[model samples]
Target chain A: MIRGLVRTAFFVAFCAVIGPAYAQGPLQLASDVFVEREIAKPDGTKAKLLEEPKTVVPGDQLVFVVRYKNVGTATASNFVVTNPMPRAVRFDGTADGAELVSVDGGKNWGALATLRIAQSNGGDRAATSADVTHLKWNFNQPLSAGAEGKLIFRGVVR
Target chain B: MDNIFAFRRNNRPARNHRLALGTSLSLLLLTVSAPAFAAGTVAGTDIQNIASATFDSPVGPVTIDSNTVVIKVDELLDVTVVTTDPGDVITNPGQTGNVQAFRITNTGNGDEAFSLVANTANGGDDFDPSLQQIIIDSNNNGVYDAGVDVVYVAGSNEPVVAPDQSKTIFVITSTPAGVANGNRANVSLLASAVTGTGTPGTSFAGQGQGGGDAVVGSTGADAQASSFLAVQSASVTLTKSATIADPFGGQRPVPGAIVTYRLVATVSGAGTLNNLAINDPIPAGSTYQAGSLTLQVAASPATTLTDAADADAGNFNGTRIAVSAGNVPAGETRTVTFRVVIQ
Candidate 1:
């Protein structure tokens, strides 16, 4: 009876340890946000972004990029992101170059066309709303585990 | 042995039940703790680090405003009096006259409002009262007598001045004919203006009156006033002039050759020019030869040229000749000459 009890206790402890490991699997999510000077390198190594505080003169265009990866066993689905714009800075656009997202703080997004037709006519250019300083990226498709993605936005210092 | 075997068989089922219960409890604990730990760790790292990183920048200094004043003489007062007796009736009769004027102005960046009160000091002769009464001490005494005091002719006092504004006051007097033309007098013009005022509660009442009243109601928080006085001596005189040929033999200087030339100046004004100094600048392409200057005035026998040869000589290096006239008398002329060579 004592031997049976010992075996039973051992089995219970083993299950406790293995169950969490099995449930968690290889799921992981990591994100890095930074700024870089050059976009390319000849040696196959890209230039790293500077992490120090930088002074940007007026009328300078600043580009920020965020890289995210799903280093997990399961897919990351319905990914959503939001960034707030800093004071004394303005967003440029969003059409691969620039774009207008929405009126309700980027809750709903469409191409610049829909925004222009609704806010201004096709004749007028789209501008960032006063309250909207941040840039956001949302994905409708799932990111397979181990897949990576990046989002970029441009702003001008006033 | 038979009893032990039977006990083992009875406990097996109970052991299995206990194992199942332990596993379920372990799983439940991990499930509850995982979400809490994840949320706390992520938020703690991001929010706290960012909050600390963003801070305040420092600031620097600021600036203010200021002003200044300068006075210059434009034209000297020239007074001439001629007396004629219809029948040459009185012998040794005397009369006095004078010409006086003051050039006061604001040559600074801002407007200045000020006042002037002048008093004549007794040296020897009396300031003539017949002249415009900017100020005068007639009895050779140091006190001002209201009844006998001369008043500023018509428009002597200026109330206000914009930047670079100026005003001139004139006074003139005539002397009786047959009076010896050797009389002399000293005159003084004292000018003062308030610049600023102290704080509202500060008391500036104890500062004596006179020109200080000019800045009484000024907006400046600190009231300040400047007082300056200039003294001039008046006299009667005779004058003469003469020109001597080039002291150094005249030679037409070649394009690059240097030739020395000389010239003299004589003064016959009422008052001998005190601390008389003259500046003669050589033409742009000229140079002064060494030791080519001399003073020939009998009254100013101890005169010297305060310039060195080979120097540019005209306002060049701010050099000139200075002379002292030991009370030159009326109707006499004194002369000084210096030489420079043209390069």
Candidate 2:
């Protein structure tokens, strides 16, 4: 009877230790959207700056940054980040060359040059950068504990 | 005052293959391609974005969504003006109520009102015309009507136009008196945004539609176009005089007196007169002498022409003498002389 009581206490201690971890998950994420601006520098040169888009208009270039961190104790494997394109903007390519873009709303994934969009007339045409509807980055290696990084892409307001 | 945008937390997993096909098909219907040179997204539109990350853990694969970020679009103020008339309007000296057509287009991304101004008496023209009234094409028929079209008063009926919409304006002016023919007159119409105009990127806070900020575009929110008025005055004048000689070499109006009648035709104005012909009917108490028609042009000697319609520019058809002077240049004179015996 004493051993049975000891087992119950041990099970209660395990539940208490693992309960918060399961609820909060192991990965933390944050996202930010900014508008790109060009300002003339003091020495007759121009510099590009990413500023909060308080007064964004159509045809303005935008930068989107997504940050992810592995907060759990163990390493995380097959880490993938996905971002859906907003309806009010058109994809203008990304500085990160490792991104896989989906022009058909994540149904098909490939480079922008290798995709085609289906037309209403039963014919398909090559997809341009503006036709991208989703962006993704897949890390083949496992993410170590407490590892953090950011991914960036650009778009133009439609 | 609300500069901070609240983010939304999305708890859905990433890369749901089962829903990808259906979601893409529906999204394709909403993906209408917008022109690259368009006025852009509507002002005050909220553009939201949310990203998700997935990874394999001891508790299996898990997905976590980042907070949504939003950006609100602002208003862009721009305008364009163009003259739609074919060419310069032709006018005569002291002409009034001439109409010049112009089109004003709002190329910005918000609904805006514009103030209209018409300026006459621009330099480099031969004369200055006076402004009569400014009319707007209220019916959008492109033609000006006295009662149907709206006469624009200074601040009273400014047109609130939508983006990419155009308003036709008619500037009425009166040509100045004593203006020379072939003279040119220039008139201009300027349309400026009622909100304001300045250098590009000038901002007006809380003045845009939906209480958003308004920024001036490349056109500076103001545009002007000019219309030309060309004076074309043309006419012809004629004078006739008679010299009477009696049978005894005395100048008297007697029954047997010979009357020499001379007709002077002068072409005036800045344009040539075509098909110019003068007709003089024989009086009731006179008899025309056969082969008595004489024709003279400018400073050359007079050449006697046959009174028949043969090989000459003169003909005596039945009762009157006709001279087909053809085309006479401006500021030129022609003379026709003939003799008659009084009854």
Candidate 3:
């Protein structure tokens, strides 16, 4: 009887310790990165994966919305994103549009200026870091454990 | 030994359960991570594939019509000659030392540059060797040579032939004294291009290189050079003389005897004659009897009659002689006679 009693107490203590750990659940870091086409208000509520626009004639104004959320335990800080400009599109500067960055597919992004000058010297206008046309919003304000933010880009479809 | 065996059996099941749980967790982590890596991956597609609209503006075709350029030669210009000697009269057989002048002119739409070559044969098909050769140098070099070239250089001062523009040229020929009565000769005027045929190159210097020269090669022959011929035949005819006798000799009042004069003129040539005018002026001393001045042949009208009552009477103006014969047909002759007497 005493052995049974002792075994029950040990099991209770094990449950007490392991239950909290198990109940804490997975450190789930999930986010729904959404891109919305800016149409008339009600229709534009539908968001999708970021995609290039079609039928971009010589003159057209376009807007893009990039929404990101952090539904995780830890804050997602110091995050950087890079995107490439389409060949058929020209970049209107950030005053009217978006801030953009480029990494050579994650190779040597720090010395981007020198790398860009070298790339321009190499006759590759598209390879320069300054050639990026993507919207980047550095969440200098951390994404506070389960927060959301958005980046907007207005472009002239040339 | 039993206690040890039982303990080992219990621990084996627990170890299997833990292994199963660990496997499930690993699978869940892999599934979630796999999507994260694939979230923003974009396929590289060409712009042409994603374009939704296209616009084009096509230009229409054009056509141009061809133009015609025609050059024609139209008139049988006259040649005139005068002699100061009384014995040198132009007549049929037995006539002596007469000089004849030919006046040729261009009555066509374009400039008629021609050369005169004499041949005795009636037709251009045959050449007579015994015929005296008269090689007239159009360039006036005073040398009788075969193939001596005469160039009709275009003059800036000369008028361009709009239509029916005329230019006259003359040739004078003398008949030798006591020659055969029926001697005759044919004079032919040959017309040819003075410059190279076909469309002339725009620039004399750069013909072979570019512009139109590359389109039409420099060595290609111009097709516009062509030749035409005109022939005129003149023959000396026998002169017939007859006296008009007064039937009644002795009369109280003898009016001046009236007489009639007749002259026949015939022309035969390679082409048709048009707008032909003949002028015969009476000798200064001869007087025309009243009511005797009249042309017998209406076709060959007398252009001038000094004795005509009206100033313009008997004048042949705008009269044409038509020859219905075939090419190089028999000669056409017409008579024009009027009366005159010595006062």
Candidate 4:
């Protein structure tokens, strides 16, 4: 119920007025961000724990998780997910190396090392992790009915 | 310099437009400019993220956007203090109102107040200077004025600074009496956030300006810097005495009496005296004796100089006797004696 309220609050006013259109859609998408905490145990060891971020600060690492599910009876094919980086966050990396990145607002997409940013002085520089503006993953296999999966990425607050 | 100019030129119009629109647009435009990672994202900033997914359905292609997620940035308390005075401040013994300049910067991403203190009793120095007052620069001029600058009071006038902004201040002190020349004293100034200070990552609930949590930064919300005061004094001391011998076999002032004058000169302190020459005028009622001028260095034999201005280091003109003793180092002394008969 709390998640439903937060989703309603996130939607635009026009979309909120015309609700239930996307609620009945075949594919449902949900996104959440978290901060990793290191918990120390009595055995003299530490474990990495993820929790809902409450007080985020600069230099703190964040985990972005996107869950997608197909609710319709029919199968979905050519699945592709795209996430734009926030202005105040620098892209770290994804859980897997299967994703492609765009440094120029999705104008071009390639492996991070193969990308270059064109400068106003008629020169170009190698694109760094900070230059990543968009992330995308393509799934070749078709999604069966009621199939669900999640994509994870990390970033640092600038 | 070129990059800064071009960056300002490219962003000024966008910045003005953002001012009319809102802060979210301004933040979006800020990403276009480079080299802004120093102060990081501002406190209370809402970092928003949204994801979209598309898949070909059995009928047609479809696209969907995930629910937006926002994480509000919290306040980070940090500070840095640095001395602005070039080298150590040169001072003298018993000097008062000596000032050591320092700059305090709020290196955090939120507005903060800082309380300042100066300590002079730090070790590894010859002596401790007495601390007087701490003054804040009231006019933003990087200088200290007695009445113009505001005196910093612990609670009443703690300095309030914005993110990445610095405040210049002065730590006033006085050197104690009997401090030897070339002696050094050090003074340190410490500035801490008025809200609180602790280890990094320590958080205080509801103490931040935006009603969020405040966390300590890498500096622990406190910083300190030291400035030095060095005493510099170079001086020379000279004393003269005269004795008379009468031609009538008595120590009396008489005609044809031989009057002998002795002058002792000494150099003291950390510096050397270059080309130190002493000249003594003859008495009004006396006449100088020929070849009577003598120059004697510490244990050296006395050497007489001629009356004429010749190749010797000493010379006697018609009215005075002059001795040229060059390069007198510290703790060294010289003596000159001459004879003049009473008229």
Candidate 5:
């Protein structure tokens, strides 16, 4: 079972070109990607932050920032954004304060502690940074034309 | 290297060679000696599979799973302790600063730190002696020179025993200020792969970057027993016989008769025969039966064998048999038997 979750690595998705069974409305999903780092404010506060990571070593803190915008003219409802936690890092928690759900390449979603993957020893171990195979964020609000929102989660370089 | 959580015989190469070589069936023998960190090979830790995040968007439950993220895992941890000498033998009133040598190898897939311990046989046959200290052969030379080798202190172990790399270690014992002539001591070197410092309970620390969680093996200990022998004495007796049962139904050998050869080796002496290897070849005019070899000892009933190296008990490849009778304690007996068909 854990191997199933582990295979989530190097995962690739195939897209099916459904010939215009019907003229489906346009939905343009544009995205922006950046790497963020928290910096300290001159006032002795760590409020100031920066982006762009040139190099990173083990046990370093890194935040992934991805912005998604719906550029289509019609409104897009129930837009769910999923960011497969990078293999090199762990999905510790949400840095953007958004409610989140994690999966071990399975259907169940819950707190990281409640999730488990099959251990090699014929037992189940609670999910860890290594166990969390994916992360998801739900935007219940509708996205009108030209509306955009940011989805950000915090992870540590393993 | 076998299934981490599965049951298997524990054939550790500890100080007791004979005992260590005793092989057992994987299912019948389940020794919780190996750490549970190892699993489905190396690449499994870094899952390359992808995740799916779906939500309703009119067309269907669209799962825009994030890009495939192969979770990286830390390096695995493992270690082994061994010695070249068969067994150390010395007379009582042993000299101070007397040293025995050993080597600890990092058997894991990643770099690891090992903490060592040298213990003396608390109390046994005659008496006990004092243990000065255990040292790491920093210079790679076997000899233990005060300044050349660094003394092993509590809480401080080897810095880095790289994967597949070995480091020499020495155990030095000093004769007490005033001691009796007949005294003994058993010293062992233990190597524990240092765990990483992470979510202590959640996952293994001490793992290579992007490696799996940490779980140290039971322990890798190679013992060096220091004896104060009043006299160099050791005697091992081997007695073998063949019993035949064939179409004739009598003890006499016949064309289709199966010959079962049984040999009992008994040791009676103060000194120990560390490696009691039993070698036998198929007799002439007879064809050797494969997988019919086995070892049995009344004292240690649990140690059984099949013919394989990883089996530990002993190994035979039809033509010849090489069984390792680890360390046969005084008054202990080991019995090995095999079957061959008379041509």
Candidate 6:
């Protein structure tokens, strides 16, 4: 009986420590748009492009950076992060060279041409920019503790 | 008083000038008297050279050579082209040597050089404007001729326009001497950033490169374009014939015979001719036949006589026959018929 009581206490202690930790996650996401500027280095050869940005206007190419970090003590599981391409901007999928899927409001996915959209004339046509609703990246690996990286894609403000 | 800009802006010119003078005088005394004060201290109070410069640099100074350093901050690049016309219009085989004006604005923060291009077959036009020349309105008189305006410099160092400034351009296009009737053309004036043109087809100078450049508007073309119309003028022809009926009730041309005169006006082009007025003086030794004037337009019925006015269709203006046809559309004809009695 005493041994049984001790096992119960140990189990309870384990649950107390691990349950809250499992419930709380540390994978955070931060995204912003930045314009590329050519910055002159102190060496003064020519200049190198650095990410210093201000206001964005029409026809200006912008880089959208998504930074993720695992600030937890344990590793994180496989997950997917999605960012809706702002309707004001157009995404060409080459900005960060990341594997991406295009989504429609109604569950459709694939490339720009293979996807089909409904036409007002009661017919289906190849999907275009209006079909692109969201961009998603599926992380295959386990996120280690203190791991941080960036995912970027390019777009132009419409 | 709370805002720095407001303080400066609200300050009077005299006060600002006095403050600026005081600051300049203090700085001048400090700079000019420095060498004299140094000499007074070195030689126990004496004279000195007024013109001398001090040095401070990474390399230790040998007090030998005088050199100057210069610094420049890179400028922003922006430019735009727009037409002041509510609509660009010209006539073909019509008005020769006409001018269509446009304004090119430099919206950049720095001075810019623009490359001018005149295109007859530019994009987004149903037809191409047969261009003659594009000139800078040097005299600001809004006219273009050989010596009156400087012709456009093709793809080279052109005008250097300052920031937030504009230049007047006169696009010279014409309906050729023998252009076909109803011919229409389009002329597009495009300006590009020649701020740093080295080669022929380079896009533009990068920002802060000490060159000139501007971001093109949303049209995806580096230059702004507005097309002007050149339409062929409607050809107008007038034919007159006279038939005389004597007291014997037959057609004759002699005196004492009633002469019936028919004047036909025909127009040919793509546009309507408005405010068309035709006047014919009564032939000598002839008296107009009262109530005999009749006007007939192509699409409408005929009308009887009236009097001289801006609105009357047919009238007699004291020894003359007048027809005031408001607008005779293209491919239509107007006929005025009246009788005159031979004296």
- Clashing residue pairs in candidate 6, if any? A95-A153, A95-A154, A96-A152, A96-A153, B92-B231, B93-B175, B128-B186, B129-B186, B195-B212, B244-B252
User: What tens digits encode model 5's per-residue C-alpha lDDT throughout B107-184?
Assistant: 554566777767555555444445787888888876677887898886755557755678888777764434443344
True contacts kept of 5: 0.13
Worst lDDT run of 10 residues, candidate 3 chain B, spans: B48-57
Ranking by lDDT: 4, 2, 6, 5, 1, 3
Considering DockQ, where higher is better, how would the candidates rank from best to worst?
A: 4, 2, 5, 1, 3, 6
DockQ of each: 0.02, 0.31, 0.01, 0.39, 0.08, 0.01
The residue pairs found clashing in candidate 4 are: none
Candidate 2: pairs in clash: none
| Candidate 6 error regions (>4 Å) | A1-158, B1-74, B122-129, B139-146, B155-157, B178-182, B196-221, B237-259, B266-343
Residue runs of model 5 more than 4 Å from their true location after superposition: A1-58, A86-89, A102-104, A111-133, B1-343
Higher-scoring candidate on DockQ, 2 or 6: 2
Model 2 error, position A122 (Å): 3.2
TM-score, each model? 0.23, 0.74, 0.21, 0.73, 0.33, 0.38
Model 6: how far residue B82 lies from native, Å: 1.4
User: Candidate 3 regions off by >4 Å?
Assistant: A1-56, A94-100, A103-130, A133-137, B1-343
Which has the higher lDDT value, candidate number 4 or candidate number 5?
Answer: 4
TM-score of chain B of each: 0.26, 0.67, 0.24, 0.65, 0.42, 0.48
| Model 4: lDDT of residue A66 | 78
Compared with the true structure, what per-residue lDDT tens digits does model 6 show for residues B1-343?
1232243356432210111111122123232322111101111111110111111212221111011111111233456787665665756564556667778876544456777777667655445545777788777665555686788767643777765678878777755565565455567677766544223222342443343222332322235667567564666789999887898777766678998888989988767787788789998889987878889888577788665554657778778988887787779999888988898
Please give, for residues B1-343, the per-residue lDDT of candidate 2 as tens digits: 0121222133222211111112122234345443344677777665667776677878666655566666666788999999988999988779899999999999998888999999897889888899999999999999988889999998999988888889999999999888887899889999999998999889898787766788888999999999999997767899999999999899999999999999999988866778889889999899998889998887789889888899899989869999988888878888999999999
For model 3, state the Cα shift of residue A64 in Å. 1.7
Winning model by DockQ: 4
Ranking by TM-score: 2, 4, 6, 5, 1, 3
Q: In order, what lDDT does every prediction score? A: 0.35, 0.80, 0.30, 0.82, 0.54, 0.55
Error of 5 at B343 (Å): 92
